[model samples]
Target chain A: MRDKTILLVEDNQDDEDLTLRAFKTNNISNRIIVVRDGAEALDYLFGEGAYAGRDLSMMPTLILLDLNLPKIDGFEVLKRVRADSRTRRLPIIILTTSHEQEEVFRAYESGCNSYVRKPVDSAQFRDAVRDLGLFWLIHNVPPPESE
Target chain B: MQTKRFAGGLRIALVLAGIFLALASGYLAGIREAQMKASGPALTRDLTIVLFGQTLHLRLSLSALGVTIIFVLTILLAAAVLFARVAHRRRRQVEAVNRKLMREIGERKRAQDEVIQLNAELEQRVAARTRELQTANKELEAFCSSVSHDLRAPLRAIDGFSDALLKDYHDKLDEQGQQHLQRVRNATQRMAQLIDDLLSLSRVTRTEMRREEVNLTAIAREVVTELRQIDPGGNVEVIISEGLVAQGDARLLRQVLENLLGNAWKYTSKQPAARIVMGTCKGRNGKPAFFVQDNGAGFDMAYASKLFGVFQRLHSASDFPGTGVGLATVQRIIHRHGGEVWAEGSVGQGATFYFTVY
Candidate 1:
């Protein structure tokens, strides 16, 4: 678990900092990799563009996805991830600030494992992160490695 | 009107002329009879000289005068009877036509009255519908405030950075500074909640309703389960009757139950043995009604009317944290279902919300 990596796909810098702070305060010491947009997230996942020539077998333990991003949006990324045999079973969780039910339903429909809203309250946000880390990082067992 | 009068005058004049002609014919016949009587003596003298087998000439003249007088009187009487018969027939025809005209006029007047009455009724209906539309328009305007996307984006920025500052720089700030930042965060959160609620209320109005058979019992159970998850320690005894169903937009009805049950959960937090019930009952108007009753922080009856208005609150935020838009949203949903919702409660007792869906 300590050697596992966590990928964060987000565009907003403040949100990224807040999420990083949440992880640090919760004592989650897993390696967190940040990508600024959906395109970068896909590139990192598929070993293309800037992430080319990287080891393909070293996939992240968990993916924290944001819906609103530049170049490509999160839903498309989720679809592409699910389509590929290599990353088909990756545990992807949607973390967004949007409170729209349509967007939430769309995220789930696109094959996300969990959906969490980024609360405006800092305390609530911290608690949400703590609970998420405890469950996904410690308690829940992931799928087997891809052959 | 003028033409009708002229026709009536012409008919009267034609009848009068017929009567006058009859009288004149009678007068001329009388004159001819007198003349024949005056010439009788001359005729008798002449006949006695010419015809001697003239012994009977005086008797023959007297007999011929008698016969001539009788024949003239019979012809005059016959003519008078024929004229009288013609005049009587014409009079009867005129009376029949006049009776027909009178009946037609009465029928036309009645038809005109019916048209006017229908026009008045149409006007009244149009006015009533216009008034209803105006009221709905006003409500829409109130719900759709001018602060849309532009306002919300800046608010998000303020909230996000303030949170960042508080979390990242907490050790640098004094106790007073920390409290100030916390207050700022709280205000921003409250403002965000208000904006979200207003937007949701407007959405309820704008969206079209899709009606389908919805199991209310299942929806209520789901909402209660979610509520229990939120407040797992609260020992609220929730009773939901089985097989309760209605026809409405499933999503919107779910929202209604969520708001109602969420309120029940929030208000009943203080009660050690809180009781909540969701079931169906007969409404005051004898319609099937769904109700949510809770032994919670019930409000005063005097302020009940304000419960469903946007941003209208009977309780303070210190006691119960709310944006005061949940019931307003519920009312909008019920109304969209062509239904009505009302609440009944007393201070320090309990509250029950009743609604009907058609």
Candidate 2:
């Protein structure tokens, strides 16, 4: 069991499943908590609404965000995360289907760690997930509080 | 001078009237004196008769003078009043017409100035909007670059891992496993191509234009010659008019011809004796219009509106292999040159694409 946790905030069900499947196929067993929209992702991070009973100290080691969502959107969620002292330094990668330049600029402006586009093919999708999993899960050293 | 003339005539008439009136009064007084003298005379009847005749003559002359004076005075007074009224009316009419003309000129000037001001404002607004659009396009291109770069990393991984699987697990897996890996590679390749085409299309928007006088005829002939060299089997006769000069970016214009000619070649594959004509024609606005006409498998007229849109393909993938950005890129190039392009075609007939380089 990996000690790190990943929060995958994606609106599309197929995308969420594909992400999970990629991790499972790559043998990356990090605990990934999936949220369907930006609002739920914010809730999980701030320990509000449905996640009120959860412990605030055990925040996710990494966040994979999608720009388009049902409510709140990725930029707003990122802004809120950066504003909070607990999650200010958290590694947030914007993994979205939109290759629109404005979305990427907005993500970077809101203090996102990196931006990535989702590939169309299933095989390429798996590979992208594997590289990210290897980098964050193994090589990258998380902060002391996250550990 | 006019007032002096009028006053002189009035003074002459008044003096004549005064003299005539004085003569008439004197005649009347003389007649009375003669009558009194006749009453006082006791002797000389013949002398009395002579005096009476003299008095009668004087009376007749005085009556004539009185009548003449009244007629002259009335005529002078009437002439003076008539002249004054006609002069006043003529001056008033002239003043009214002059005021109306001046007002009309002022109004026309104001209207023209307002139109000029509105036109200036409209031009300013258009310039500002064009700048905003340019900025947005630049940002979009940047985003496409990021996408292309990031997407390539994953594509590399997919092709690499799949190849590894094929090399290592060749003995363990059967024919079906090899086919699956090949499919994976093919899919990755197609995806890569799509991304690359998108990147190219985005790049077309940002490339700075280098403008110069280009001989479109020479370019068209060159493109056709190249095509002929590649495929010697096609019996396509190319007619290119010479020395057609236009102002444009040479490289971009060359690309435009390449795409258009390349399309002509692909569509005319079925015709045994294909006739391709590249020359200049008169445009809608009386400008020189360059055209590439070919006897090929032309598209339907209904889908002409979609020809310039990015990734808009009229033909199926099986019929034609392209990212559907050739005509779109052509349009962008011509549009950058401040020109326009349009295509005319029928379902089973040939197509002619015309463009203007302004």
Candidate 3:
């Protein structure tokens, strides 16, 4: 439970299930901690609301965020996280169903480390997840903790 | 200088006086003959005289005949003058009528020229507007291309990373964990399709149209074949009447068929057996018309007006996958050909699109 974790911020249940499956298929060992919306994801990350009692020192290795949500969308969440001293350098990946050009550029402008679009074919979906998990887990080194 | 009416009155009066004079001359001749027959020594004159008691009058020989001769000469002069006056008045009236007629003809000619000039100016203005619209369409197409390029970058990253994640982690994830990965991939693919449709709409509007005689049947058949490739399992029968030709841009006509027939294929995916037909008939304007009829998931009649509007979709995204640009593109193409396009459908029954390039 204390090992490196993944913060998956997604609204749709089906998409959330698929992400979990992608991680498993790719053989990633990190524990996936999912929130249903951007607000909940922030709450969990900052140890606020229901997660007030949770330990703040247990930081996740990566955050996968969806752009569109019920309230407090991913851009606001990313901005808030980057502005704060404690979680400014946290690796945030934008994983959404939107392929709008403005959305991609905006995500990068707002300090997201990476962006991803969902795929249709199940096999192709599985393959994309496999590659993504491998690259981040094996190739990319996590940034150091902020002061 | 006498007025024509005054001169006419003078001539008539002179003519009456001459008639009396002629009668007097004849009477004088008669009296002279009678005198000669009676064997008179000398016949000097015949006269009738009137006098008062203090006045005396003498009659001269041949005095009546002299007066009659002068009277006849004056009457002949008056008659000639009267005829000339009447001729002069008639000539003046005729001249006035000719001048008025010429003026009226000139006015009508000017009005006709002005009308012709106005029509030419209106045509020039319409040409200018068409050019402006074409330029606007080009700009929109450029914008769409840029958007598509920008959108594709992130999509690639999404698919790439998810694949990496699934590849590097397998043993640790439970069955529930595995399902989440699949959903992420599905969403990305749907987004890519929407972007593609946006690009297609932009392309259709921007491209310059080259019109020629096009075979509608060939386009329909080709589109049907393409649709079958996309949905192999979906059973749909397509009937196309061969050799129905029209004056239009071939590429645009092909796009129109693709959109209409493609919609047929997509909507009829749920049906056990689908029927689609393409044929020609007389249009509402009594012109040659083409039609695409399909038995599919048709839309509500109330929302029919929105069918050709950009991004206006009647069905939900979760049910029917589209960016809602196909029919809009089709409409634009048909309109550019100087033709008309319309659709008829009811919920769950079917849809038919009719177009004419007259």
Specify the highest-DockQ model's number. 1
Better of 2 and 3 by DockQ: 3
Using TM-score as the measure, the top candidate is: 1
Q: Which ten residues in a row are the worst by lDDT in model 2 chain B?
A: B41-50
Number of colliding residue pairs in model 1: 0
- Provide the lDDT at B123 for model 1: 100
Candidate 3, B-chain TM: 0.60
Going through the candidates in order, their DockQ values are 0.13, 0.03, 0.06
TM-scores for all candidates: the values are 0.61, 0.47, 0.46
Question: For model 3 chain A, where is the 10-residue window of minimal lDDT?
Answer: A117-126
RMSD for each model, in Å, please?
12.7, 13.7, 18.0
Which is the winner by lDDT between candidate 2 and candidate 3? 2
Off-target runs (Cα >4 Å) in candidate 2 are A1-3, A24-27, A83-86, A121-124, A137-147, B1-94, B97-173, B177-181, B188-192, B195-331, B334-358
lDDT by residue (B270-319, candidate 1, tens digit) is: 89889999999999799989999999989999999999998899999989
The local lDDT score (0 to 100) that residue B170 gets in candidate 2 is 91
Off by over 4 Å in 3: A1-147, B1-141, B175-177
Candidate 3 lDDT score at position B155 = 64
Candidate 2 global CA lDDT score = 0.80
Q: What is the TM-score of chain B alone in each candidate?
A: 0.60, 0.55, 0.60
Model with the higher TM-score, candidate 2 or 3 = 2
Candidate ranking (TM-score, best to worst): 1, 2, 3
